[model samples]
Target chain A: MARVVVDVMPKPEILDPQGQAVAGALQRMGVAGVADVRQGKHFELEVDDALDDATLHRIAGELLANPVIEDWVVSRTP
Target chain B: MRIGVITFPGTLDDVDAARAVRYAGAESVALWHADRDLEGVDAVVVPGGFSYGDYLRAGAIASIAPIMTEVVAAAGRGMPVLGICNGFQILCEAGLLPGALVRNAGLHFVCRDQRLRVETSDTAWTGDIEAGSEILVPVKNAEGRYVADAATLAELEDTGRVVFRYVGGNPNGALADIAGISSADGRVVGLMPHPEHAVDTLTGPSVDGLALFTSVLRASATT
Candidate 1:
């Protein structure tokens, strides 16, 4: 089985309130040097050998992530 | 005319939407997310709710549901479709509308009686309402802020696709006070306010929201 992982994040220009809240909590906890934080989604898929990279990418783009507000990265995981 | 109200797993306003349809003198049909059938309804309404528990994004998960495929095709063929609140989010996620609904600027779920001005009366959903008419309705959501690229915003302004604008005060801090918008052909509309909730004075903030459903019925009659 091939294991694939997907990381989806808000666009760079979009506002991320949840990420900012997390960053604020970290700052209050005395964690320094954090410029910003952008929260995102992570998904892991175990695919059969028959599923090609193109199919995986299609799933990520069309089903897993919304292109309007999110960008996704797909990679093979060990 | 029959209006279809879709119900996803977590849909909360399907009943209200159907009631609004009936109040406007149209038959209401119930559609299921898992079903591919559209039941030949003349129009469709994607009612509000926390569909799919809003897991990935507000409307991201519900956008790909089986019934949306038919809705999208029908919308492309100039069928009227209205998306309210979470329904608005789902429409944006499905690429049936422009922009995306994000978290409110205050980062809290706002629930209140909201005032809105009808900016355009060209849409299939707002044709009965006169331009510049102000109405009160209830809006409730955590991710009701609307955003799009600068160019798209400009295009929407230039084309008069802006259907509704927030008035009195901006509840969710939507960009440019835009409360709702319509497609280029005026067959589709999406908004963050709950019009169905305001259709009855006995149970809601006001009866102002009934105009939207009545407008569709009137438009259907003329066409």
Candidate 2:
């Protein structure tokens, strides 16, 4: 079995209101030195070792993230 | 005329959408998400709700349902399809429409009577209304902001595909205050507001939304 992790984030040009809200809260809580915050999704999947990287990429690109508004990175976990 | 109103597991507005179709003097057919058949309905309406609990993303799962495969095919042949609220998101996710509906700029669920200007009445869904006329409808959603890349945005603007433009004030911070848009052929349309909920004055802000339903019926009759 193999575990894959996909990290999806809104594209740089897209607005991230939820992330901004978190940034605001952090400011109120007296946290500093933060440049900005952008929210995203993280997905972990367990699949057969035979699953190829191309197939995994298709899954991540087609289902895990919306290409129109977000970008995703897939990495295998040990 | 017969119109199909699709119901996914978490759909909340199918009944209301069906009722709106009936009020427009058409028969409403209930369609299931898992079914591959369209039941020979002249048009389809994908209504609002958190389908699949909005897992992954709102409208993401539902957009790939068995029914949508048929919906996309039918739409390709120029069949009229109207997607409201979450349905709009599904249509975008399904690539039936251009752009994506994202978190509202305010980051809050907005529910209110919104005024929108009819940008173009050339589409199947807005044919009964005059272009530039303003209509009041109920807008409700957390992720109602419409977003597209700059090129797509320019194309939509250049081609006059924007169907509805927020009139009074933009409720969701959608780019260009776009409340609704249509496909290149104008047979497919998706909008964030709840036009189904506004077909009657008793339940909605105005009877203006009835025109959308009537418009499709009129389009069907001529075709």
Best by TM-score: 2
lDDT score for candidate 2 against the true structure: 0.96
TM-score of chain A of each: 0.93, 0.97
Residue-level lDDT of model 1, residues A1-78, one tens digit each, is 989999999899888889999999999999999999998889999999688889999999987887767899999977
Q: List the residue pairs that clash in candidate 1.
A: none
Candidates' interface RMSDs, in order? 1.4, 0.4
Model 2 ranges off by over 4 Å: none
Q: Judge candidate 2 at residue B164 and give its lDDT.
A: 93
lDDT of each: 0.91, 0.96
Candidate 1 to truth, TM? 0.96
- Model 2 chain A weakest lDDT span, ten residues long: A26-35
- As for model 2, its CA RMSD to the true structure in angstroms is 0.7
Most lDDT-accurate candidate: 2
